[model samples]
Target: MRIISLISACLISTAASAEYIRGSDYGFKLWEGAAYTDDESGQFSHCVVSAPYKSGDTLLISFSKDKTLIVGVANDDFNFDINKNIPVTIYVDRRQPIYATAIPVSSTMVTLSMPNFDQAMHYIQMGRTMKIDGRQFSGIYDLTGTKVALERTYSCAASYYDYASAPVQPDAPVQQEGLSKTALFQVATNMITSIDVSDAKYLSEAEIENLGFGAASVFWQSDDLGILAGTLTAHRPTGDLRATDSQDLALMSDFCEGDFASSSQKVSHVEGVSQRELRGICRLDDSETQIITTKTDIGEHTLYNIVFFLNTEKAGEVKRAEATGNIAIHAASYAIE
Candidate 1:
């Protein structure tokens, strides 16, 4: 399954007709939705950047606390090309060259296809799959400009779970047999339970009365097992669904250089997808781990090592906006082999 998004930054030298990425703000009209198709790879994606999408819109660009950099154009701007053109510089460790490029993406997102290449590419995270050189992965790719700033791309693997068929029941219960208790939670247990997004309950009356124009997923216990219910929120862009699922598979990592710091302490984990650091941590045991990886985005970026914990538990109750902004890990009992 392609569980990541990619954002690319290409070196664009400004000629008379070429766009420059100086202090220019390629404003956008906050496109309600924007889509990007990668030229080198046949991967395509869409997103609804934060608010403020308009022409000449300005947004700050910087690397994660870890010193890892990504290209971004906020103000709800999108499309690698279409609107404003900013500039930027991409830097990598032990790398040489102040590669430069204008942020080809317009601050506003519209359907687009762009060409990108990096002679001096930075090695980010890489290992999120069973070891196989020919295998594909899904994650984000942040291409910082040699001088300008643009929004990031939510990149995914070229060959991902094909949803071309009608969307599979996100709540379908998948079963597998022949597993030991020790390794059950690793993959089957979690996914078996996660096949569904779960059910919801408006605890208080106010929640139900004021419930409108919002997206929600509620996981409750139908007996001892788990049942899920999801509601699409109103007033949100049609892009919300894309983002919600994209985030689950977003290839973009919040990369930086440094130790886990008191600064941005809350943001600890992130989904890494750069060729360099893609296959970061090794799995201790696979038969026991369903998706042998984690995604976090808080804390200092310069940590010598990053650790994410995944455990299993019963579906007592699971709520969004819960678990301290961290992904909620619920309990799932796998079918006995």
Candidate 2:
């Protein structure tokens, strides 16, 4: 791992040059180093550089993780110390949620929400571009470390409505338990944001996916019950490549308890099926929320993950789906879109 101050590092362009991964957007990996990591809290946090630049430049922001925010810059890591006497309102990340603004200097205190927006906002254009030290970013890549490209359009996203029929409260936090080692390893890498399935898309009529795979995304938008979105991709592992993912809306609607044995009863009969030795469930208000990711070598097993959502108005528990040993890899958290 290499760390250089903005003044000492290699300077490059600021288009969209992150090489190892695409999109320096928040909740993603940029360049080659670690883009996702675990802090003291169980919550997954991600950091990506806007484009390597100086402190004098502007940093674009966006929304994510329900109401989480993304604030990227073109400089090295550092802390900003503003006078408390000036002005104060919780500065959000344009992508996250915040209780109330405060006058503090710390990572946790920094709100990820810029001002508005959530996971469902889909109107993409450009928005406000504030300075690193409170000015406008000249849109230049001041530093270089793999030539991360600078962004041209800044965006904000969110969606909401009268959420009354929700099986679960939209904003309620779910308790995470029974995290599998595979899932834990993924969570440590902040892979949760990358798990998704596809609705099947063909890239070429003359050709099929090398191994029948592609890309997908799950954003803050609820499927009316929860949050999920699936798609097909022509991109997947080819050779000895190894990866793990967590699909948010991998749903299995209904199944008879008698369909499986007691040994297979990993969760509630109505909560769908879980195979691996590990699984978790959360009770959110009158509804239930669950998260499970694991691996095993044996016979067939069925697991389900549901994102029962109605647009962005209501939420419900997601059903789980059983997976194949190889296909379960899609459950990994680092697959690219």
Candidate 3:
């Protein structure tokens, strides 16, 4: 998955495109592509999900945040010849062939927009194979995950605007075995101003909502175990956060002592983006709870603070919860550059 993201970045740079990212929840995959201006400023962008062929080519369907749908295909190996009216036939599941005009993007890629995008999606979701122009040059690609992926893709895309208008409410809790606890809260989206759009191949509006400067908050609970884990974006602090010297450590220690008992502080190194960090572990509520907090400067004045609390009785859940939290924060943190 990481390799795919990296390659897509290179493809975008050589193609000279906007910052975007790809995310998946079900069988379909979403790509948030951007269009920038000559002043190195973003002009506009949108969310798109594409199906990849075995030959390393892809057929993409994009959903503009404006509520329009677009269809296109890309092959990094193609030596495409541009013509004003390029004819192409797209066949989904061997149904009646649909024809459209192909617009060449580079020597390697081309796209076409069709009016019947929903119909095209239907054919792909049925685990049918997609072929172009009788498949003389391209290989057949499976569309098994198209349905679920598309739903997740659009949901995340919509989340960008949804949060702007109002805080998004959490859906009903997901059922977990041997856990009987739940935590829920709404985080105001206005705290975040904009995303750090740099070197990213595709940036989904939804991703920007949760990244660097957006109002990103999380809530989860395990009912049976009474375990709650949450984190959120905070206003930038005025003082330097990268201070790991004696004076800074002393200040942090004092702060931790005021909030947690038997607290220990240290300068810890986390893999990925180089930055100053302070890690502290302490017992709260008379040692009944363990609190682990990390503060890292993702960018100048942009600090990401992660907090974790776990009950002593729920040791089994700690590993899974910690892993999920770390993976999410790490991904979001590194994307800033």
Candidate 4:
């Protein structure tokens, strides 16, 4: 499925005041068929990649300047009320259905916003097909080139946002021979800001030091959710030495005092960096705690650990996807400084 004349029609109808800018190709039949800018201000508004099916329906995926992801559908034969919101369920392969609200942009086009961006991207990249079920319309679309398309879209956003050129403070300490407290604090602060932690309150440097958890630690507590998350960096001189399961258990034991029963463990890589993630339950008498820890090698014989301790009683209320997503962002954002 490739986009044709429908791309122009979809974009023009979706946003009347937007003008098409340059086009970009992401390979494998995925192209930025509609890169739009505001007609009045001449600024980038959004970029879209689309696929048209034999049924005359076109599937569109777009990324806005404000970092909103939208999945929309366009059909010439469809006639819908503009600005109407409809409830819909999206199913990717055999994964659980995502319930979302679709807003009609035009009489023939409707868009749905993804609530869980990481999960949605994962499903689209790994799945073969996506089915949208709604009261007004339903269809299944092939997801062949979505993985590369999404990667390119993310790259486009990063370049447009100038993330690579983001300035680091000149006085920020750098990690050279050993772990520096100032460097760790700066890295932790950058990680927190990058992840956009607006709901939690972070502990001060004095408070963190008073806790006796060592100098290379940053802790944030969400009192409303009863969750404690922190990062710990340690200097380990074992170059290129991959920790075994027993060694991982021993390391986890240092962070979790109670008897730990490992529920799952896996190694994930992002942007050439590999991280070992472990999730388990800690039990001591009548109390239980859920712990998630990710260990990543940040070059120069340094290991960075992100640990999350969740209250077992409020575990269901906590957004585990967001937590794990933050860990991934941290893994990708952290440098040896």
Task: Give one digit per residue, the lDDT tens place, for model 4 in 1-337.
Answer: 1342344334434444555442222223533343455555555655666777888888777776778776678888888887578888889988999887777777887777667867886898778999989888788888976765665555444333321111337897653443355655665565455444556777885665443343346677765555666666543334442543344444345445578787445555465665667676778877877667666666643345454555666556556657565665565455423
Q: How many pairs of residues in model 2 come into backbone collision?
A: 73
Report the poorest 10 consecutive residues by lDDT, candidate 1: 297-306
Cα lDDT of model 1 by residue, 1-337, tens digit? 0111222222111221111111111111221112222333322222212222134332222222122333334333334443444333433343442434444443342211112332332221221111101111111222223121122322111112111212237787542222222342243223334433343222232332122111121112222323322211111112122222332222112221222211111222233311011112213334111121222211111001111112223333433223312321321112111
| Reference-based TM-score, model 3 | 0.40
Q: Per-residue lDDT of 1-337 in model 3, one digit per residue for the tens?
A: 3333333332333444434321111122332222212113332234455556667777665554466655556677877665543666777875877675566655656666444766765766664567666222444566655654455445434433221111235895432221111110221111110111122122233543333212233433344443443333322213344442232233223323335433324333454544343344455446544434444444422333333344566434445334434533453443244
Give candidate 3's whole-model lDDT: 0.41
Sort by TM-score, best first: what order?
A: 4, 3, 1, 2
lDDT, candidate 3, at 308: 33
Clashes of each: 99, 73, 14, 0
lDDT of residue 25 for candidate 3:
16
Choose the strongest candidate by lDDT.
4
Query: What local lDDT score does residue 86 receive in model 4, on the 0 to 100 scale?
Result: 82
How high is the CA lDDT of each candidate model? 0.24, 0.25, 0.41, 0.59
TM-score of each: 0.24, 0.24, 0.40, 0.42
- Order the candidates by lDDT, highest first — what do you get? 4, 3, 2, 1
Q: Candidate 2 — worst ten consecutive residues by lDDT sum? A: 155-164
Among these predictions, the greatest TM-score belongs to: 4
